[model samples]
Target: MPTARWRKSSYSGGQGGECVEVANVAAVIAVRDSKDPAGPKVTLTASGWCDLARRIKSGEHDLI
Candidate 1:
């Protein structure tokens, strides 16, 4: 959909890791597994992406 810039997660390594690539489409964020670039993708709203990002930055999902 249009010219979206898909990028791999910063946490993704150069040696091929289990990471997801993200693309910002019009009003949605698209995510796909880096290992499977041609696989299915999930889309999220702006708010959803923001919430996920915040949670990730906070330690919400960090069980350590």
Candidate 2:
């Protein structure tokens, strides 16, 4: 894959604790910990990324 251009999540707090970074790479969305720029990362298909975002917005994974 080519070098990815990462951007910080808009939901990230200015204080910057537990932040996430994302990049668009071809047909996938690349994700990584903001604190670990050089660490292992995850890649998800565009559809999968959209599904995850929708679920998150709907609170599907919220702790009871």
Candidate 3:
């Protein structure tokens, strides 16, 4: 497989704080810490990615 082209969110701060990078790897969506490129990564299927995004947008994972 070709090297994944990771991209950070436009909303990410430039201060190098909490942030993540995402990439499209074949049939999966790859995610990793932006501060730790060589560290572990999470891979999710297309459908799973969509669900996760929806949940996030709906504040299902929010801590109040």
Which number leads on lDDT?
3
- Cα lDDT tens digits, model 1, 1-64, are 4477888866677775678889998889998887887788899999999999899889898878
Clashing residue pairs, candidate 3? none
Candidate 2 differs from the real structure by a C-alpha RMSD in angstroms, to one decimal, of: 1.8
For model 1 the local lDDT of residue 40 reads: 89
Ranking by lDDT: 3, 2, 1
Please give the RMSD to the true structure for each candidate, in Å. 2.2, 1.8, 1.7
lDDT of 2: 0.87
Rate residue 26 of model 2 by lDDT.
89
Q: Model 3: per-residue lDDT, tens digit, 1-64? A: 2499998888889875579888999999999998888889999999999999899889999998
Instruction: Give the residue spans of candidate 1 off by over 4 A.
Output: 1-3
Is candidate 1 or 2 superior in lDDT?
2
Task: Sort by TM-score, best first.
Answer: 3, 2, 1
TM-score for candidate 2, please give it: 0.83
Q: What is the lDDT of residue 27 in candidate 2?
A: 88
- Model 1: ten consecutive residues of lowest lDDT: 1-10
